[model samples]
Target: MSKIIQSFEAKELKKRPFIIKIADRLTSFFGSISFLILNLLFFVSWIIFNKFDQFPFPMLTMIVSLEAIFLTIIMLVSQQRQAHIATIREELDMQVNKYSEREITKVLNLLKIIAEKQDIKLDDKELDEMLNELELGYIERKLEEQLSEKQKLIIDLSPLNKS
Candidate 1:
């Protein structure tokens, strides 16, 4: 977990322009409850003052629509950054898992050899099978197929079970 945090911190340290940093901070703040309250207060004050025809405030509606458009753009930019980070994390995790699997296989083989040298009989068929090398490509392909099948089932059922 510490390693993961360090990796994420390192990733965040990459150089970004001042405007982008400001935009990121702004978007992050925009998602908070405080921002919601701020907007609520603004709307209430506007109504109390009769700022633009109390009940059917067309100006307020227009302002909100414009704000929505800009917010959507900001959200898209942030999501793109997040998706890039997710891809990097996924690749890192895959590499670590592959390395760990190889190391485990090496250790298991060494233990088996040591047991044999000591004249110790180890007769676990499952352990012997595990000692064999993993076929990562085949496993990955199978996993992808399973995921696609599950996605298809979800897509097929979603409309019929709509809330």
Candidate 2:
């Protein structure tokens, strides 16, 4: 318990957005060269085994079916992981910046007020698109700032560090 508390206080975990985590995991799983090797091995083994004089076709079919099932599971896991990331991003999009519900709501209200002040004549669809684009941009900028700060801290810790 104390170690866990210390870890949290240390804040050593990378402060990446959930979407990034999903992308990394997906890339690691499906984009890996090992996956390609495994696939190639599976294909070659199936073909070679099938060319035998007493080819056990039914057994081979069963093996292939099992492989398909496992492949599907892997694919589903990757998909769900990505979907989880998207869900987190969507939620974060709704609530990031200012760190308080009231402040966030105030910001949204202020944006509406500014649009009104400017007499920004946008249709509902256009307005929604603009608002979403603005929010995404804000979040992206925040992420960049955080990354820069993290990089600086890491550099400061190194012997040859120069900022």
Candidate 3:
């Protein structure tokens, strides 16, 4: 299962464009503690070495501002790429869950048959429900309706919403 997931992730990575790959690498590097320490050291060194008469070094500020802008853009691109991968992963998980549910249902049906063949009297109401085919769309709709109602209740109960 781990190998399968690794292979899936590798395939996803391979499908990304060259530029996105670079951005991902940059994002990893930039998000590291090492990058933070390096930036801190660089800023401290710049301030110490430069004998500027001005209080707020314009050049340093400009350089930092430009770096911030570029890094922000890089981070946004990385976030977009991550969001896409997350969406793909979510879809894959949903498929796996559906497949598992079907397999489990089949197993339960087989167990019920085996129990009857062995002359074992097992009366389970839940088993009857388990044997029935799931209407996924109806279940999803019901779940959404329940969640929406709960969300509305939560919003209404919030202190911010109170007069």
- Please name the candidate that would achieve the greatest lDDT relative to the true structure: 3
| Alpha carbon lDDT at 90, candidate 3 | 83
Query: What does candidate 3's lDDT look like per residue over 1-163, in tens digits?
Result: 5686788889989998999989999999999999999999999988888787255889889999999999999999989988988897888888888998999999999999999999999888988999987889998999999999999999999999999
Error of 2 at 151 (Å): 46
lDDT of 2 by residue, 52-137 (tens): 53455676677779977866766676566557656755565556432454565567667888888999754576545544324556
Arranged by TM-score, best first? 1, 3, 2
**Candidate number with the higher TM-score (1 or 3):** 1
Runs of candidate 3 with Cα error greater than 4 angstroms are 150-163
lDDT, candidates in the order shown: 0.84, 0.64, 0.90
Colliding pairs, model 3? none
In candidate 1, position 32 carries an lDDT of: 100
| Residue pairs with backbone overlap in model 1 | none
Q: Give the range where candidate 2 is weakest over 10 consecutive residues by summed lDDT.
A: 4-13
Question: For model 3, what is the C-alpha lDDT against the true structure?
Answer: 0.90
What lDDT is reached at residue 129 by model 2? 53
By lDDT: ranked, best first = 3, 1, 2
